[model samples]
Target: MLDIRRLHMLKTVAARGSITAAAQSLALSAGAVSQQLAALRHDVGVDLLRPDGRTVALTEAGRVLLEHADRILAAMEEAECAVAAVKGTVGATATLAALPSTVARIVAPALTALGTDHPQLAVTCLVTDQAQLRELTLGTVDVVLGQRYHHVPETMPKGIAVSPLLDDPLLVVTAADGSDERSFGLRELATHHLVVPPATTDCGQAILHACRQAGFTPTTRYVTADIAAQLALARSGLATALVPRTAIDPATPGISAAPIEDHPIQRLLFAATRRTETTNPTTAAVIAALGTAARQDHTTYLPPA
Candidate 1:
């Protein structure tokens, strides 16, 4: 019989594209991962990988095995979840990866709700960037909280399930002491020194793309992914920023905020789960908690019509 653990290691190596990277992700040494792969190759009686200079390429047999490995691992995960469900047991760990924005606003409330309502289920949340989608698809994490820009939509990976949590609008942030009567228009915004997240980020891309659509490019003077830093700059008379409504802390002072007219840029905050793990009771509980927190956030922060 093929060793399940070794098969999983092979899958990780394949997903990561390198023995070293796979080892780091799995908390194993490169040598150890290599040994396991060698053992797995021997057991399968096939050449699963071939040397390609500093790296290795999956052999045809390796590709075939990888396909089966994904299914086998998913099936095993599903079986575990199913058995726990059938036993009516809720005590299990559900790992989640979330972007910084969601972590800032949604994680605490969601965790508190989970602790109160499903005490038996436990969660571990990681703050990550857009890379979490790959981890979710590989089953390294059970779920991911992510953002999708309306103008530049995120293409969902195959076999992942998404649940929308919030419709987050972008807000123009400037010094609270500045003219409250200042108008909002992408063209006007282009004239100012803009503070934005790194252009590589989805939020940053959304803001930049909207400005370009308005027939002008912003003069971005400050770039950082830290929401606090961006707001601080806006409050300090340094530059204006486009921020998500969900990322604003009500207690924070010194910043004036207004919704962009016509909603030129908006993002959908959503949670993604591996389709195979969708039935896991612990994962389901966590998703429910996230949904509840998001609903409350929208109610409290978003202006009522």
Candidate 2:
């Protein structure tokens, strides 16, 4: 029998036009993706992709196979749903996606509360750069806490039921002593060598656009894969950074966090659940916990940038 994993390769390649993107999506090396595609070609008896300079593009036959694969995946999901329904209990399993700021401050508290009171529920948190859609699309998780930056969005994704949580303040953090640096407006702020988040991350984009609007572009001296690294960067004074208020425990000294002059930056955290499971009790409990946590940020919450 042909491998289900190879079909996933075809689907991944289809979703992300380039093989490089597919590899990143699956967290696989380029060579690994190439091997999988080779297996996929052997199974299907056709040339599914071609090398076009740096990237691979899928052929017409590849696209056709992808459509069928999508149906198969959806049906498999439906079957899983049926099984899950039959095995239903008040508490099953839930996965959560959150930014590090929320994870440290609010999410941790809520999870603690849940664990103390409701131990039966299995909760796993995947905290990193935004990949909220993964929870909903792949059925990897039952809930997601997505960050909303800049002008608030008027709408949410179609299939998800959204509940607005709270606003997270993004602030500029630097050494307290003015000897090395002094407060500056947007233009100067942009040029300052900054410690940045990942390239495609929302926090990274927020800092970039806010700087551009204020008039200059940020020269990122360093970028971190994890939010926790920002503190060390700030401690060393190697680069200035914009971080969530909660991340910086206000009581912790050596750093002065100032609201970004003239530029307002806040993140709106939202609790998202699949609309199809409107009355999931476990989801309801999770939302309640999140609401309680948001109302009272255990960690010192900052004002907008």
Candidate 3:
């Protein structure tokens, strides 16, 4: 019989595309992962992987086994969830991945609240973005806090469940005293030198699409993947940026934010989990806590209508 643990290692390896990367993500030494892969190959009597330049690539047999591994591992997780349900306890480590900006508003408070409310359930937070959606589907994380722009909707993969959390409106951040705290028209934004997140990201694409819809392309002078970097450029009077309200630092000394007037760009924030793991008591508890925290944040931080 194939070892379940080795099968899991193989799955992680395939997802990561390299033994070293899988080892780092799993907190195992590369040698340990290699040894497990070798044992798995012996048990299955097949060549599962082959060296590809500096990294490793999965073979046809490896791809087939990896598919089976997903089902087997999911079955094992369901079995554990079943046992935990019978015990009527929610005690296990649940890992959550989210974007950097969203973490401060919702995730941090949820962590504190979960500790007080359910001492037995431990939650680990990982900072990631939409680029890591595959990690969420592969079971690298128990849940993910992701955002979807109205202009650039994301297609959730099969077997994943999403819980709507909050609506984060995109705001314009400019040099202090440059624009009043009122909505500015998209035509006005076209005249400004913009510093935006890389267009490859969902947030960036949303901004570009919204601007185009208004009949002008923004003159993007700088592109960064970091929100803070975008804000810093805006604060220095070097560029203007469209940022999610959650990403704005009200205390920052030299920047002011305003909503876009005609083209209102907003992103929907949600928590995602594997469809099969939703029934796990620990997962349910954490999801509930996230909702509570998100509601609290909206009330405390968002401007009243």
Candidate 4:
């Protein structure tokens, strides 16, 4: 079967005139350009180009192929635009990607509300972080719930639409049973065992920065990335950890979260759409519900750092 991508490549090469120029224009390796051109010639069963000293010029067959390719692609683009305007009342699929923590706490509730209201929409949740979430802005996934720390660069991907969904508090957690004092100063925490998040992660780095500001380094007992495991350690008297306040579950009833007196961390959450006029109706409905959930979620706001 003829490949559409190879046809597009042939069309591009013909328009650009030279293979070297086409490679540069397309940001593809010179070898890849040469291979695709050879494949395109074989696929069409014709000699498509003529060598003219250093540069190559398209023969009659190549010109004909280029014309056809351009017409086909333009027709496809028009079809996409036309169909995208239709409302998806019949049946549609929507995929939502979010961090593991956010998927459990925030996305689950929003998805529940959507499922109850819009029975035609099927929702699938994928666990991912901000970097992965940014990639889905290309329309790979219908909606993305991204979690970002305070100090991380305040950047939203261009060409994608976004809505702020929730603001979650990152807390300093310890054993509720062991500490008689409700609150502790910087000096008191320096003496305890800390199970810090991996130094590479945002949560771990934030806790490290707070300790440095307090004029001491935390003695880390374990280097772990899972906030749940860190919370478990803190509850079992193995170590104290910094975790999101919403992460505390009664099933793991040992750990207790207390807001830091010195530094309070708040995470920004955003819901994204590939484009405002996307074809997916389920995505549109989810976006509307998320806006409602975000406004209702405004029960308490943690102070920013």
lDDT (Cα atoms) of all candidates against the true structure: 0.83, 0.72, 0.84, 0.68
Candidate 1 scores a C-alpha RMSD against the true structure in Å of 2.3
> For residue 212, what is the lDDT in candidate 3?
92
Distance from true position, residue 270, model 2, in Å? 1.6
Which stretch of 10 consecutive residues in model 2 shows the poorest summed lDDT?
Answer: 296-305
* TM-score of every prediction relative to native: 0.93, 0.66, 0.88, 0.66
State each model's C-alpha RMSD to the native. Answer: 2.3, 6.1, 2.7, 9.0
> Which TM-score value belongs to model 4?
0.66
User: By how many angstroms RMSD does model 3 differ from the true structure?
Assistant: 2.7
- Residue 240 CA displacement from its true place in model 1, Å: 0.4
Q: Candidate 3 regions off by >4 Å? A: 129-131, 176-180, 249-254, 302-305
TM-score pick, better of 1 and 2: 1
Q: In candidate 4, which residue ranges exceed 4 Å CA deviation? A: 1-91, 129-131, 178-188, 250-252, 277-281, 291-305
Model 4 steric clash pairs: none
Residues 1-305, candidate 3, lDDT per residue (tens digit)? Answer: 99999998998888788999999988999999999999999998989999998878899999999888888988888898888888887786888888898877788889899999898777888887663567877677888888888766469886688899899898888878743467788779889999988888888888889989999999999999788898889889899988898776566778888888888999998888887752888888888888898898877774212
Per-residue accuracy of model 4 over 1-305 as CA lDDT, tens digit each = 66666776676666566788777756798799889878888888898889877778879998888777766654554455456556436246777777766654566768888889987678877775344544463234667877677866777665466777776666667776754435445556798898887878767777777678778998998998787788778878888887765454434555666666665666777788665344445566787777666665455333222
TM-score order of candidates, top first? 1, 3, 2, 4
